[model samples]
Target chain A: MPASKIDLSPHNARAYLEPGPIVLISSRHGDETNIMTLGWHVVLEFSPSLVGCMISGGNHSFRLVRQSRECVINLPTVDMIDTVVRIGNSSGRSVDKFADNALTAEPALRVEAPLIGECYANFECRLFDDAMVDRYNFFIFEIVKAHRARRPKHPQTIHYTGDGDFMVAGKIVSRRGLFRPGMLGNGRS
Target chain B: MPASKIDLSPHNARAYLEPGPIVLISSRHGDETNIMTLGWHVVLEFSPSLVGCMISGGNHSFRLVRQSRECVINLPTVDMIDTVVRIGNSSGRSVDKFADNALTAEPALRVEAPLIGECYANFECRLFDDAMVDRYNFFIFEIVKAHRARRPKHPQTIHYTGDGDFMVAGKIVSRRGLFRPGMLGNGRS
Candidate 1:
């Protein structure tokens, strides 16, 4: 079934991204578009909705994102494990990823990049800083728009542990009672 | 039983950290020591065993880590959930975390920062780059040494979502056959 998504406040991006799941980064420049499996990313800030992605120079999508200065960060669930592995193993330079994988590429609200409709959540991001790009291939982006699946309050995301192994998102536990009033919803802790 | 740890090659740090569990960063400067609950971290590189941590300036451990230029990233298991919540709730400036929480601090081999004896894994890190510190509070650290428990190979680690919720690490799945030979253990994925 196609996932139903609802618009989310960009400020609340930390709720989805802080858990550190493996994400599929989709990029488009001119006539070229590509999707790459990415796990090296960090949430930098909550207000501007910043995230840092380290796209290695070797990946074909790296040049696409670097030139376009925009991309869509898509959260893929455990059901897409095989597809994720295929995307990570193949280079976009050689394959038409969307057509080959039979994944839907829907129009993003803010960025030029296309969002994967089958994914649980999609964050349209615009490049906020390129200073780290030259040295580390790290692009700090502002999540201009966010969309998440409405039904599954907590999606079963996959996290890479190298060597073709992935750890699936498990049970949810809340310590809200223990957290101070100030720290409960601030997104810092 | 106390964890019987075996030394791991720093290059293999990705196997433990790329999964993106909430880590406890322990740092020491002079006679003072501190530990902070960190969720914003990413495995940046494999060769130098580099990891980037976004340590917000507000945390008391920020000053200690910055001054010492060294820290131990400790991976806590699901069993330590309550301790993790308490540590994140309290400030290191006011509390001696090790003493107050009854978390034993063991001398590290390479860094002044002590390792959390109870953690599943400990990676001794040295600050590699601080250029992004002032602007983003992101510090790139090189893992100089690594250690992990022998038993419970797949530890149940916790990943934090906002509002005091956590997602525990779940089942492991491997797609080794799908990965190309080169991508199997290189750690880029």
Candidate 2:
């Protein structure tokens, strides 16, 4: 199938703005594998770590996460908006979405989940046994490994709005605080 | 007090690009009250209904969420990005951030937590239980009331990419498969 077209104009920007994280949640149930878009996810902890996401009971990916207790949280940039939307809209119940969308999938080093090649970052997570999954459709996972893509001079990403709209990463319009060495915070500046 | 400045650009966009929902968390401890930024949050379930957020144990806001078992989740759109960033960087620990930042705070109808003006949406939540929070620093909340700012022509929202970079809301790039009405598959397109 031809890749879905994406428009990043400011006028149609909301499609990308709603709870904006686009994660490729990959899992395997038995021998079958699938990937889905998840915006209802977050980092839960930093030490000995934990991460969590909300998955509706209706999704096939939810079942896979439940059964496997593992998944790869693949963070995609705006460049992968079309692919993210494609996988999100189609249910893996019947469609072989990976093959359908032509998304390149690679094995995760620490988890059974697969990672999408086009994404900017990948987090390999193992399910943290928690009680909220049923009470709130949320699952907490522990990050085992993380990878950042080759730095881009202007690496923009996509955010999800309520509807089909999406938002492309934008510029840093302003700045505050210090950037000099010997200052309190130090890293990339 | 003047708000502290943060050069969000240093994180090279990773600051705003974190794969999580940006939620405004509010709490009151004794005579002191505070609000802070939370992007490490998610909705966990629907049956008993619950919400989840990852908070640093050391922050004042975390103590509020912990002591009260009650908190609020305020969702803001792209328009509120400036306020969000301002509140995210400034702490209510020392100063009245609301007054300093020109932020308006009002009592939530359902919960004691305060609702922030200028945000597009809000979710009033109470802690679901203590089982997971103690182990993972994850707080799952039960939503009591949910509201949105007057509907926008296109309700695109701001998404953080990490550090100080954010993604701009975009348009409905395209769609596929069966026609739906809301948000890609839910129907609206």
Cα lDDT of model 1 by residue, A84-116, tens digit: 999999999899999999999999888889999
Residue-by-residue lDDT tens digits, candidate 2, A3-84: 2222122211122222345677888878878888887666554455555677778889999989989887776777677778
lDDT accuracy of residue A183 in candidate 1 = 81
A66 Cα displacement, candidate 1 (Å): 0.5
Retained true contacts (fraction), each candidate: 0.89, 0.29
Task: Report model 1's chain A TM-score.
Answer: 0.96
Give TM-scores for every candidate, taking all chains together and pairing residue i with residue i: 0.97, 0.74
Task: Give candidate 2 misplaced runs (Cα > 4 Å).
Answer: A1-19, A151-155, A174-189, B1-21, B46-49, B76-86, B154-158, B168-189
Q: What is the TM-score of chain A alone in each candidate?
A: 0.96, 0.79
Worst 10 residues of 2 chain B by lDDT: B1-10
Q: RMSD to native for every prediction?
A: 2.4, 9.0
The most accurate candidate by TM-score is: 1
The digit string of per-residue lDDT tens for model 1 on B115-166 reads 9999998999999999999999999999998898886768899999889899
- Model 1, residue B48: distance off in Å is 0.4
Candidate 1 segments exceeding 4 Å error: A1-3, A186-189, B1-3, B186-189
